[model samples]
Target: MTQVRFMNWYLKIAIGSAIIGGGMEFFMINTSFYDKVTVLEAEKGAYENSPQSQAMREALNPWRNKDTEATKTP
Candidate 1:
């Protein structure tokens, strides 16, 4: 009788944990967290593809030749 009682308790805990975990995981992944990440990635890609981003990159390049700088004429 004691063995059966322990087995029942174990089975109940296991099944309850599985159900609760499945629900929690479903909510977590379906939240705005994923939406925000996707939006952030899209904005990042758009900025990277913009001409302004390329100009900023060139202006910030350390290895660029001094002759190419806009402050001075050839």
Candidate 2:
């Protein structure tokens, strides 16, 4: 009888742990925050690819030490 009670307790614990683990995994898989993150990243990429972005990049190229005088002789 004591063995039966022990087996029942073990079964309950196993089932409970399984439920908790599955719930956390399901929540992670169904979350929507990743969608919003991806959308924002795509928008930023698009803006960086625009003509104004190209011009700004070109203007900043000089400051990036593109001039021959800025090159290290080493």
Candidate 3:
């Protein structure tokens, strides 16, 4: 015997709506905040081992006290 469909019309519509909503968010055309972060990280590497880079990092992350190199040390 064949089994009948468990999902009803409302359920399917709800699932479809949820999928489209999620897709809209996931496939957004806008550049995200993390994209800016990745670009800033690349810039950080561009200024490697420099006082300017240290100053920029400090200005960016004021909550943190020490720089990466300094924190890496004992």
Candidate 4:
């Protein structure tokens, strides 16, 4: 009887851990934390290597370099 109760407890804990882990993984991958980590990694990469970061920097930079054509005077 004791052995059976222990097994049940173990099974419940294992299942609960699995469910929580799955949820955490889903949240981490689908939420802003993932993007934040990716951005940090990209920034680190950009600091270590220039060429690898150029596109990422352009994508994140506020003051971009793209030119706009002149408009007609009103």
Q: Quick one: best TM-score, which candidate?
A: 4
Cα RMSD (angstroms) for every candidate in the order listed: 9.7, 8.1, 8.0, 12.2
Question: 54-73, model 4: which lDDT tens digit per residue?
Answer: 76777787466443322333
Q: Candidate 1 — which residues are off by over 4 angstroms?
A: 1-27, 62-74
lDDT of 1 at 56: 91
Predicted candidate 1 versus true structure: per-residue lDDT over 1-74, tens digit per residue = 99999999999999999999999878878886778889999999999999999889888985576656765875
| Candidate 2 vs candidate 3, TM-score winner | 2
lDDT against the true structure, per candidate, is: 0.89, 0.86, 0.77, 0.81
Q: What's each prediction's TM-score?
A: 0.46, 0.42, 0.31, 0.51
Worst 10 residues of 2 by lDDT: 65-74
Which pairs clash in the backbone of model 4?
none
Candidate 4, residue 50: the lDDT equals 79
Rank candidates, TM-score, best first.
4, 1, 2, 3
lDDT top scorer: 1
TM-score of candidate 4 relative to the true fold: 0.51
Worst 10 residues of 3 by lDDT: 1-10
Q: Model 4 Cα RMSD, Å?
A: 12.2
What overall lDDT, based on C-alpha atoms, would model 4 receive against the true structure?
Answer: 0.81
